[model samples]
Target: MIGPATPEGTLFEGRVHHMSIERLLAFSGGPFTLNHWPARNLHIDPEKAAEAGFPAPVASGLQAQGHIIRLLIDLLGDAWSRTGSFHSRFRRPVFAGDSIQAKARLAARRAEAGVTQYTFDVWCERHDGEIAVVGTAACTVHEPNPGVQAA
Candidate 1:
């Protein structure tokens, strides 16, 4: 299990985290696909995907974002859920059979209002070395309170 983060600038510099592969499959009522027939270009039919100029059915941009979030959660645990914020742009289309992973590096840090906040540069890249998504994330890792009793 991962431990709590160190001081603001002491952790995650040049660090890399890889997410597990997820196969993009057609779901009958999936998010973004609900009541949208044209959205089938995401998974149901490869021919339709090719006709739309993609080599295969493309995964949703949210999938790539989920991978990046998973990486952050694994590294920061509940701290990320409580205080993490991210913004991402989809750079390239991710196909159904593509393998992808998330990577991150510590970009900066600061102490504000008794919290140590960290910022990271994060991205999701396909196995072919193409970047599918890029983003920045900021999170606060709170310090443990010392259990000092009054004398």
Candidate 2:
């Protein structure tokens, strides 16, 4: 969703980021081999991962967090990205090949020193009805960046 159409307590739910070995590697900055993935180094068993519905080793929790953060930044613009800090509790393991969705509901909004501060309850849920991560995040929207303006 775009800016808050409703007053202060607006909410937004984002689309899912489908997980895959290739997608994980791309997020890692290259086409990484299975041997290079963190799960490999941790001695994660391929058979066990397969039973967990993963085709191969899963991406790290931090990697998934980065994906969600990027998604939020894209929606909220530079304000949230520049000043926001996201912390989450990993409730369940997100395996490779599992589709996950990042959702945020505005918990509160207030004005302070001319800045609009917004708080949200954010979470990522697996397709299997498991919540992989949940947390509260807050961001302050500042004046638009000089380099780029929102169209």
Candidate 3:
């Protein structure tokens, strides 16, 4: 679970939640080759990807977005779930074999109407040091529930 609200200017980062070739394929809807003709770029076949101009099968942009959101959730917990908002742009394709890392720097915080709202500059970088996605996220910090005890 997430702890107290992070101070402004704090940096938070996390490694990729691995998405293997099998997992990517599964996420795109079960097994098939480019020859068998499943959805475009959904299979792991390199030849098909090369035909499509990518060196290999690329992971879906949604998957990369999910990773970014997961990073925010890891840092802010329910604050993110209940009030967080994200806007992201995919700058580059993330291939199936690449590892990803998410990082965020808290840019600002303010208290209003019983909640502390936070703004963060967030990005996900590929293992090769290229930023694959970039965005801003906002989450509101609410008071802990006194009636619910921690486990």
For each candidate, the alpha-carbon lDDT, in order, equals 0.66, 0.65, 0.74
CA shift of 32, model 1, Å: 14
Give the per-residue lDDT digits (tens) of candidate 1, residues 31-107: 65456643445354678778888776777788777878877776666788778999999999777667787877777
Candidate 2: deviation at residue 112, Å? Answer: 3.5
Candidates sorted on lDDT, descending:
3, 1, 2
Identify the candidate with maximal lDDT.
3
By TM-score, how accurate is candidate 3? 0.78
What is the C-alpha local distance difference test score of candidate 1? 0.66
Better of 2 and 3 by TM-score: 3
Residue pairs with colliding backbones in model 1 are none
Give the 10-residue window scoring lowest on summed lDDT in candidate 1: 13-22
Over 1-151, each residue of candidate 3 has an lDDT whose tens digit, in order, gives 2334447788777766565787677667445644653554534666777888888888888787787787777767766667889989989888878888888888887876666677889898888899989999998777562222221
Model with the higher lDDT, candidate 1 or 3: 3
Error of 1 at 138 (Å): 0.6
Candidate 1 Cα RMSD (Å): 6.9
